[model samples]
Target chain A: MPKVTFPRMGESYRAFRMLMNDLGNEVIIPPRPNKKTLDFGVRYSPEFACLPLKILTGTYVETCMSGAELIITSGGSGPCRAGLYGQLHKKILNSIGFPVDIIVFEAPKSHPIDFLRKVKRVNSSRLSYLAIWECVKRGWEKLKYLDDLEKTTHALRPRELKKGSTTKVYREVLEWIDGAYAMKEIHEAGKEALNTLKLVPHDTRRAVLRVGIVGEIYVLLEPASNLEIEETLGNLGVEVHRSMFLTGWTRDNTVKETSGILSVKEAAMPYIPLCIGGHGRESVGHTILYARDGFDGVIQMAPFTCIPEIVARTILTRVSREHNIPVLTFFLDEQTGKAGMSTRLEAFVDLIRRKKNAPVSDNRIIVG
Target chain B: MKAYMGIDVGSVSTNIAVLSHAGEILADLYIRTRGRPLEAILAGLTEIAGLLPAEVEICGCGSTGSGRYLAGVMIGADVIKNEITAHAVAASIYVPDVQTVLEIGGQDSKIIIMRNGIVTDFAMNTVCAAGTGSFLDQQASRLNIPIADFGELALSSSAPVRIAGRCTVFAESDMIHKQQMGHKLTDIINGLCEALVRNYLNNVGKGKEILSPVVFQGGVAANAGIKAAFERALGLPIIIPRHFGVMGAIGAAQLAREEVEKTGQTLFKGFKIAGLPYRTGSFECGGCPNNCEIAEIYEEDRVIGRWGARCQRWDVL
Candidate 1:
């Protein structure tokens, strides 16, 4: 069986690892994207390539160096540069003389049977179809459980009486979830984690500011890329509501092709009438939804030179104006400084706080 | 009399403002940083200390700007704020009913939308130096005119020539071409100001509602040419507040006062810090593959601060 490896994206990697392991393959999870990973990626990647692509390249190189024979990454088919990432990454890796087989699970929009055949090839385990289905189900359950725990952590982090309590608990909970092998054990661990979170002293009286974070999935999920924006906001007494979750994204893309009502595309209609590829439409839609949901503010973060995001940004300004909801946009690149980001975040949080406390009769026209 | 102090150490300039308990500006100093923030900060502090009455005691202190962390550590600031908050706070204090604040500083520019003394929304120029005071300074030097006279020269021009302001490099070439075509220097200067304002509106201030009672400040606020250009661009009276150049420092001081009021104590090290021996050094941490450049600040021989490490292993605070 070929040893498989994949880049990390939040807790989704754990599920991927479990699935790959069950399929009779040894899984080597690449180290979390860090300074070295970025350095490796930036050195070889095209200078104008977006941050995610560079980081992905770095992860692949690192995995290849670590003797991972097979690399599995998702594929996109759209006007966005993401669609070309698979081919580009394969070419870049080949040019660097890295020995690895790359498999991209592109959505079965055109060649349905080819996608099924590719999936069957990856699943080399000679188990019954029922057993394979059960394994997949268990893997999904773990992913869902991890997502739920993360949601709880997000809600409780700002309200915790002692700073870092929620984070400490969250770390312990993640370990508990990761350690559980069986479905029953996973359920127990999740329940135990939720109970542990409840024990953290919370300040119920404090009015926590709510802010929604929407942007590229890679940056949003990876802490190192976005500088742990959610954690930063949480530490600043803010309850952050993220627009993208791994499970939610999986469901949106695979399970439900048509997200009819309360959809991001529908919400983004007035501003961006068409899907301009990538998550541009979703970014605009989520901001509007957040505003309508009475969030104090929304932060849109994207990689520098990302085409879809750049297009979304121009329209976001109009959305911000028409909706009368404040939106702060950050374009992250290798040159982006932590201190600069910190300053902007601090100022943004302060602005939101001031706006929240202002007298209701300020006479400005209100909009949803 | 007790005084609160605020220091803003920016890329091009360092500003210090001392304020009394009644929110009155007691002493303010603006000095060119010239790549030496420590010296500029010390000079501004010493000048401010000398200008103020001996009876006035320094109570609380705050720091803001790109070099805020360094300044905060050096001054023992009670409140350390970003330039955005500092500028917005100062503008609100100066003009209580200010709905919009267009602040163009030495290295950056920002559009702050305020409603009823509170900042509702704000946008800063992204990694661009075209819409800043530095660009104007460069243009002024190129035109063989002192930066002090650039604004007045711009205001004097009746027929301002058009210059491309989308990029600094393009704008410079456009200015040269206009100059070669026998355009008046004042007209070119005015044109440059207009170009900057247009760039600001199209980029930083894009989709931002520019309401009236607009307060313009920052180092560039001293330029009448840019102020007039902004007023013309917005078709609204741009109010340049008193002490516009030192507003960031003033805002920091005001925030420091607020901090002191809440805590009933301050972390201020006092004005004596101006004479203290301060030094900064950086080294690459080899603990991991990250190779983070850890910067350390020394007061005399004791290391008072350390930062820039991705992992908290090297962080002092």
Candidate 2:
């Protein structure tokens, strides 16, 4: 059987690895993206390509270098550069002498049968339909558990009495979830993790700033690429609510079809009448939703030269003006300095706090 | 008799300002950093200390600008703020109804949009150096004219030529071409100012609503030529505050006062700190593959501060 490898995105790799493993294919999960990973990608990638593309290419190269013969990655069917990443990666890898079979899953919207066929290829065991269904069900359970642990950590980080306690508990819980072999064990470990998080002392009285983070999925999910923005925000006493999750994105793009995706498109209609590809529409839609839901501020993070997010950003300025909600955008690249980013974040937080605490008659609408 | 002190240690300059309880500037000094922020800060502090009366007490101190953390640690600042917040706060105090603040310092420029005395939107020009003060200074010297005289000369021009100001290199070559084309020196200078103003408005002020009561300040505010160009570009009267050059320091001082008022205590290290020996060094951490170069600040061989590691391994100590 061919050894199949997939790039890491948050905790989605856990479910992907399990599903691939259960299907009797030898699975090799590339190491978590770190500085070395980013450096490799940066060295091989076009200078102006978005950070995610470079990182993904780097992961493929690393996995291929480690003797993996087959690479599985997603494909997009939109105007965004992401749709072409798979083709570009294959070309770049082959030119670099790393010959490997590449499987680019077709977008379910255009080629549902092809997507199903590609998925079934991972099931080399040729198990009974019931067995395959059971394997998928177990994989999903673990994915949901991981997502829940992250959500709890996000909520508790800003409120924890002890600085860094939430992160400590979050790391331990992730370990527990990753180590669990059975569905029952995963649920038990998740419950124990939630209980452990709850035990951390917290201050409920402090008026914490609530911020909505909307942006490109890779930059949003990958902590190393974004310089740990969530952790930085949490430490600065701001509670962050991210608009994207791995399972949520997967469901919206595949199983649910247009149901969950339509609401966001509808919300973004007044601002962006057309989908500009990638997560551009979703970024605008989520910001408007967050503003209407009374978030203190919205922050949009995207890689430099990211066309889709740039289009969304220009529209967001108008959204911010019309709705009276503050919006800050950060364009991340390889040369982005941590200190500069931190300074901007600090200034933004201070601005939000001052606006929130100001007297009501100041002619500024209190959004949160 | 008590005063709050604010220090702004920037890459190009170090500024210190002392404010009375009524938020009045008592003493302020602006000194070139000359690649030595520590020495510049010490010299600034020593100068201010010598100018103040014996009865005046230094109650609180704050730090801001790029070197804020280092200066804050060295001065024992009660409050440490980023340049944006410090600049916004200071601009607000100078013009209570300020809606827009255009700050062009030595190496960086920023546009801060305000609504109801609160900063609503802001953009900084860290990536581009064309629209900043240093570029203007460079042009002034290349023209064989003092930077102080360049602005006044520009104001005297009857017809200002157009110079491409998208980037420093292009603008410099364009200026040379115009000079060879036999344009009047004053016309060329005025055109340079207009080019910088155009670049700033397009880059830093892009997609931002510039509302008046617009207050323009920073080291670059001294240029009457740029001020006139801004007024023409925005079609509004640009107000330069009384203490334009030291606004960041002033804002830092104001923030220090606010912090001290709330806590009724200050962590000021006193003027004697100027005499202490401080040194900074860096070493690459090998704990992980990141290999972050951790910087450490030493006072008489005792490490006072350490930073630059991405992970918490070197941070917690």
Q: lDDT: which candidate is best? A: 2
TM-score on alpha carbons, each prediction? 0.93, 0.93
lDDT, candidate 2, B6-107, per-residue tens: 999987889999998888888989999999887898899899999887888989999999889889988889999999999999998978999999999998
Candidate 1 Cα misplacement greater than 4 A, ranges: A108-111, A126-129, A258-262, A362-368, B141-145, B156-159, B176-187, B283-293, B301-303, B309-317
Which has the greatest TM-score?
2
DockQ scores of the candidates: 0.53, 0.49
Poorest stretch of ten by lDDT in candidate 1 chain A: A253-262
Which pairs of residues clash in candidate 1, taking residues 3 or more apart in a chain or in different chains? none
Query: What C-alpha lDDT, on a 0 to 100 scale, does residue B297 get in candidate 2?
Result: 88
Global lDDT of each model? 0.86, 0.87
